[model samples]
Target: MNTLSSIDYIIFVLYFVLVASYGYYVFKKKKAQEHDSKAFFLAEGSLTWWAIGASLIASNISAEQFIGMSGEGFFVGTAVAAYEWIAAIALIIIAVWFMPVYLKNRIFTMPQFLKTRYNDSVALIMAIFWLFLYILVNLTSILYLGATAITGLVGDATAGTPEFQNILHLIMIGLAVFALIITLGGMKVIGYTDVIQVAVLIIGGLATTYLALTIVGDKLGVGNSAIAGFKALMNDSPEHFKMILPRPAATTGTINTPLNLDIQKWVVLPGIAMYFAGQWIVNLNYWGCNQYITQRALGADLKTARTGLIFAGMLKLMMPVIVMLPGIAAFVLHKHNALPGFSGSKDGAYSAILSFLPSGLKGLSIAALTAAIVASLAGKLNSISTIFTLDIFSKYIAKEKADEKKLVITGRYTVLVASILAILFTWNDLLGIGSEGGFTFIQKYTGFISPGVFAMFLLGMFWKRTTGTAAIVGVVLGFVLAIFFNNYAVGIFGKETWLYTAYTYETLGKDGLAHATTEIPFLINMGWSFVITVATMIGISLAGPKINPKAFMTDKALLKLDNRTIAMIVITLILLSALYVKFW
Candidate 1:
C-alpha cells in the first residue's frame, strides 16, 4: 500500500495538532519578549539546555539526512555515517574551544564575529555570501528534497508526470507554510517546539528502521527480527559495512562498459583520503561556524551552551542508526530481489524502505520525516531572517539603531520573503539538484566556501597576528582555489600529480545519457584549497603587525571546562571510538 490509510491520517493529524498547540503555548508564554530582536531571533536566555540540544539535532537532520544520507547509505553504506560521527567530535571541539571564544566575546552571529575580529568589508562580503548560499543552496535544497520525499509517501504519483509535479508543489508550499507558522512565533517557539519534533522524529525514524530490518530478516528466511535483519544486512552487503572505502585501482572501461562502482563511491567519499582532506573542514565548518547551526547555542551562557552542544554530540552518536540503517537494509533487500519495482535511485532508498512500514507506524515515520524537514526549514528561515534583518538591514538600511520591535518585524518579513524565494527556486528544480543527488549536491556546493570560511574563522580566532587584509584575501582566495582544484586542477596539474589523482566515472546527465566526468575528489580539493589559503593568509599577515589591533582577546578563565563537560566529552569520545573500532 503506497497510500496512507485512515489510521495514518489520524495519527498525522494528531501530530500536527500537538505541534501546533505546543507552538502556540510557547508563543503565548514568550509574548512579552516577542518584540525583542535578540529574544525573537536567538531565544536569548529562554531556551533550556535540552531545548538547545534538541533544536540543534532537529535543525541539522533534515530531508538532507533522512533522504540524502540514507540514499548514500544505499549507495556507499556506513562510510556516509562519517558525517554524523565526526560531527560528534566537531561539536566537542566547538564546545570546549570555539564556544569560549564566541561566548566570551559576546558574539551572536557569524557576520558579527567576522566584523569584530576582521573588518566591515570581510563581514559584509560574507554576510551576502552566506545569504545567497543559504537561500539558493541550503534553503532551496531542503524544501525541494523534503517535499519530494514526502510526496513519495503521499501516493503513487508517477515520476515526471503532471500529477507528480503538482503533488510536489503542494507539499513544498505546505512545508513552507508549516515552517512559517513556527518561525513567525520566534526562536523560543522553534527551540521549545523542537523538543517535540525531535521526539517524534526519533520514535518515528526508529520504527521505520526496525520495520525495514525485520522485512529484510523475513525475506532472508530468518525470523522477523530487527537484530536478525541487521545481521543479514551486514552479512549480505559486507562491502557496505566498511568505514573506509578502499581506494579505486586504475581500471580500463568505457562509458558503454560497466565501470567500477568503487570509483563512483570514491568520487563521493574518497576513502581514508577524506579523513585527511575536506571531512574535518566539512564537519568543523558546519558544526562550529554555520549560522543555522551555531545560532541555537549563541544566546546561552558558556556553561549552558557547552552542555547543550555536548548533549547534542551524544545524540549525534545514534543518528546514523535512525537515518542510515534503513538504507543499508533496503540495499540488502534489493540485493535479495525483495524490493520489486524499485527504481534504483539511491535517494529513493529511505522512502522505498518506508513502504515496508505498517499503517500506524508508517504515519509515525512520515511525522518523523516531517518533523526533521519542518524543524530544519524553520531553523534555516530563522537564520536567513536573522542575517538579513540584523546583519544586513539593521547595519546598513537603518539610518539609526532600529527599535527592537522594528527589528523583530523585519525578521518576520525576511522569513516570509525567504520562504517564498526558496519555494520558487525549488519549484522547477532550478539548481539541478535531482541530477546531482541531494546529498552530493549540497556537500559539493557548500564545499566551495567551507575551506575559506573555516580558514578565516580558524586563523582569526587563534592567530591574533592574522591581519584584516589577509582575512579579506583569504576568503576570496579560498573560494577561487576551491573552484580551481575542483574543476581545473586535474586538467592543469595532470591526472596523476603527486598532489592527487583524478578518478574518471560515467554518470547519467540530465539528458539520460552517460557522460564521462573526471575530477579530483572534492574533499581532497577542499583540503588543498584550505592549506593554500591559510598559507597565503599567513604570508600576507606576516607583512603586517605581529598582533592585529582588533584581534579578540581570550582569557584562561573563559576557557575553563566544568566536570560535567569533561564527563560528557569522555562519554562521546568512548562511544565514537567504539563505533570506529566496530566499523573500521
Candidate 2:
C-alpha cells in the first residue's frame, strides 16, 4: 500500500471534524426543544422539500450503487443505467398515487400502512422482515463496501495493515461513528446533515469523474480520448460491452439466441428486467409509503413533499452520468493491467479508478468516495432507527407516553445499538468468502431481497383483492423464488457451458469448447425469479376468493386529475425511451 501524503491526511482529518461538528450542532438544536419521540423520529413534522429531496437521494445512492453498479457498468456498458432511469419513473408514480395515502393516514412507517391496510399481524411480519433485511442486506453490506473502498484509498499508512482484516475493522468503526452522529438528532438532523453531505457527495463524485476524464484523455493522447477510448473498448470487447449479449443455451456448450432482436440480452438483462418490473414498486413503497424515509416528506406540507419528490427524481436522473460514466471510463483507461504498486492485476472499474488517478487529485477523489459512502451509511442508519422507534418500540416494547426530549434520547440509544450491530455484521467478512468472483457477494444477496420486496409491495398496492394473507404468501414465495433463481436453477445451469464453449472455440476450435464453459448465474436467477413470482402471485390471487374491493380503495389517497401526475408519468416514460434509443 502507498503512503498517504500530509495533504491527504489533513484532508481526511478535516472531513471527520466537519462531519462531527455538524452532528454536534444538530444535537444542540434538538436538545433545546421540548423533545418528544415523535419529533425526534419524525423531525417534529417540519422539513422542506429541498431537505427531504436531498436526504432521499443521499440515502439511496450509497457505496453499493456507486461501487457495485459502476463496476458493472465498466465491465458491461450503459445498460446498467437502468437502476437510475427506472427509479425516476418509480418516484413519479409514488408522488402521484402513493404519497396522498401516506400523508392522509399520517402513518409513521411502511409497515404501519400494512397494518392499516391489512392487520397488525401482517404489519408485524412485514416490519420484522424489513428490519432484518435493512440490517443484513442494506446497512451491513454498504458499510462493509464503503469501508473496504475507503481503506483501500487511504492505504496501509492510516489503516495499519494492507490485509483485508485491518481494512474491514476500519470500515466498521467508521460506519459506527457516522451512525452515532445520525442517531443524535433523528430525522431533522439527518435532513440537515444530508443537505451538506449530498453537496459533498455530488462535488466529490463529479470531481472523480472530471479527474478520470482528464487523466484518461491525457493517457490516450487525444482531447476526446475518453470518448474515443470508450468507442475503442466497445469495438474490441463487443460482447462484453453490448447491451444485448447472447445467453447460453440450455444444453451444455450451446448458445441460444432470443426470438426478439430488440430485446436486451446482456447478463444484466434479467436483473434489469426484474428491476424495471419490481424496483418502481419498491421505490414507491420507499419514497411514498415507507415511514423512516418518508417521515421527511410527511413532515413537510403537501406542496413541499411533492416538490421534494420531484426534485429528488431530477437528481436521480443525473446519477448515471456521475457514477456510471466513470466506471466505463475506468475500463477504457486501464485494460488488462494492475494499477501502479498493486499486488495483483486489477479488473473492472475500481481498478480503473486506482490506475488513472494522479497524485494530488487522488486525495480529493478519495475524500469524495469516503463522503458518498458515509452519506449512504448515515442515511440508512437514521432510517433504520426511525423504523425501530416508531414501528416496534413505540408500538410493542414501550407504550409509555414519552415527550419529545425523552423520545429523542430513546432514539439516540437505538441508533447507537443499530449502528453497533451493523458494524459487527459488516466486520464478519462475508465478501471475503466470495471475493474470487468479479461481482461482490453483497450484490448477489441484494438481488434476492430487493426483488421480492418490490414484488409484494406492487401487488398489494394495485390489487384491491390482494389480502394480507396473499401479501404474506407473496413475500415468502418471492423470497424462495429469488433464492432458487439466483442460486440453483439459473446460476448453476445457465452460462458456464456456453461461455466455456465460446472461449474454447476461439482458442482451439470445437475440441476445447467442452471444458471452457463458464456460468452466468445472475441472469438465470433473475429470469426465473421474475417468471415464478409473477406466476405465483397471479395464480394465488385468482384461486383465492376476492375480498371486497371497496376495503382497499381510499378516495383521499388517490390523486385528482388536476394534479398532472398522470401526464407527468407518461411524458417521463416517453422521454426516457427516447434517451435509451438515442444513447444506449
Candidate 3:
C-alpha cells in the first residue's frame, strides 16, 4: 500500500516540530547584530570545524543529490556517482588551493572576489547572473523535484482529483515555508540546524539503503539479508555494478547502452573523457566557485575550513552506498517487475521504492527528503540574499557608509522576495516546464553557464593577464557557444552533432516530443566549452594587453604549499585516481 500509517504521521510531525524548534532556538540564542553583515551572513566567522563540515554537506546534499542524482543512478546506473566522488577531490582542492586565497582577501561572496580581482562590471554581471540562475534553475528545480518526491511518497500527482492536487501544493508550500523560516535566522541558525539535519540525513538515508537491498533479495525469491541480497544482485543484474560505460566505435553510428536508455543523453558513460577531463570542469565549477557551497567554508578559519573539507570528502565516499544504491535497487526491481508499485521513470525509482518502507521508517525516508530539500533551499536563499546585498545593492546603489541596519534589512527583504519568486516558478513548472526528463534535463541546461563560470574563475585566479574586457568577452562567447551546441549544433553540423566529436546517437521520435537525443555528452560538451573560453580569453589577453600572471609572482616563497595541505591534496588525488581505476 502506498500510504503512511498513524505512527508514520507522528514521526513526520515530530520531524518538523523538532527541526523548527531547534532552528528557532539557535536564532534566539545568537541574536546577531543587525548592523553587521558578517554577523548576519557568516555567523561572525566563529564557526568550528564540525559546524562548517556539517553545514557544507547540508548545503550541498540537497534535492539535487538525493532526488536528482538518485534519479540519475536509475537512469544511467552507478556511473552517475562520479558527481559525488569527483566532488570529494574537488573539496580537497578547494580547501588547499582556493580557500587560502579567499580567506586572505576576506571575500564575502564570489562576485565580491571578482570585483576585487577583475572589475565592477565583471562582478555585477556575475552577481545578476547568479541571482537569476538560483531563481530560474536552482530554486525552481529543487522545489519541483522535492515536491515531486513528496507527491510520489504521500499521494499521487496524476490522480486527477482536487484532493490530490491540494495534498501536493500543501507539501510544496510547507517545505518552502520551513526553509524560509530557517533562513530568517541567518547563517548561525542554518549552520547549527545543519548539524542535526545531517545526522537525520545519514541515518534515514542508510536505513533506506539497507531496506532496499533487503526488498530486492526478497523480490529475487532469495533470502532477506542485505549482504546476501547484494551478492544475489551481482549474480542477477551485474550490469548495475558497472561504474564505467563504453561508447560505440567511430564508424558505428549508434551506441548500445544498457537498458538502452538514450546513448547520447547518458553522458557519464563516456569512459575516459568523464574520468580524466570532463568531471574536473563540472566538479570545480560546483565545489570551488559555487557561492552557496564555498560560503560555508568562508565562515570558519582556514584550519577549521581545511579540516571540515577533509571531513566532507570522507563523508562523500559513503554516498554511493547510501544515496545511489537504493536507486539502483529500484531500477532492478522495476526492470524485473519484482515490485507491484514499480513505475519506470527517471524520478520514479526513488518514489517507487518508498512503498516498501514499513510505517515509521517511511516517515524517516520522507524526513530525509524533506531535510535534503530544506537544507538546500535555506542555503540557496541565503546566498541569493548575500550576493544581492553585498555585490549589487551596497556596491552600487547604497552610499559608502550606508546604514548596516538598512543593508541587513535589505538582505532579509531579498530573501523574502526570492523565496516568493522561487515558489511562483515552481507553480509554473507544475503547470509544465520541465515535467518530463526531471533532474537530468535541468543539468543539461546548466552546461550553458557552468563551464563559462569555471573558465572565468580558473583563469582569473591563475592568470593576471586576463583583463576585464577579455573576461567579459570570453564569458559571453561561452554562452553563445553553449547555445549553439545545445540548440543549433544540429544546424551547424548538418544533423550530426558528433561529426567533430567521437560520440554518436540516433534521434528517436518520442510521442511527438520536440527534444533531440544529444550525441555529445553534456560533460564533454562542457569541457570543450571551457577550452574554447580559455582560448578566447588568452588570445585577447596576449594580443591586446600584456600583464604579469598571478602565478608568476617574484616571491618564490609563495609557491610553497603547507605540509598538511600537501598531504591532503596527495591523498585526495590518489583516492580519486584509485576510484576511477576500480570503477573502470
What's the TM-score of every candidate structure?
0.98, 0.82, 0.92
lDDT of 1 by residue, 104-182 (tens): 8888899999999999999999999999999999999889888988898895687788888999999999999999999
lDDT of 2 by residue, 1-584 (tens): 55457776676667667766886787687775536666676775567778888988877777776777677666556666766776787677677666776677666677777777667776777678777767776777677667666666654543334475676586669666866666566677778777777887788677777766665555565554446545554554454444334543334333222322112223345433445444444455456545446667766656667767777777887887677767766666555442444332222365347435656556666666666677666766766777776677778887685555555666677778878787776676554522432234554565565555555666666676666666677667767877764445434554344322111111123365422323344534544565567667767777656763423566753466444444545666777777677554
Candidate 1 Cα misplacement greater than 4 A, ranges? 251-259, 510-512
Candidate 1 lDDT at 19 equals: 98
Give Cα-based local distance difference scores for all models.
0.91, 0.62, 0.76
Kindly report the root-mean-square deviation of model 3 from the true structure over all alpha carbons: 3.0
User: Top lDDT: which candidate number?
Assistant: 1
lDDT of 3 at 129: 85
By TM-score: ranked, best first: 1, 3, 2
Model 3, residue 299: distance off in Å is 2.7
Screening candidate 3 with a backbone cut-off below 3 angstroms (N, C-alpha, C), the clashing residue pairs are none
Model 2: per-residue Cα lDDT at residue 248: 38
Across residues 317-380, which tens digit of lDDT does each residue of candidate 3 receive? 7787777887788878877887675556657678778778999999998888888889989999
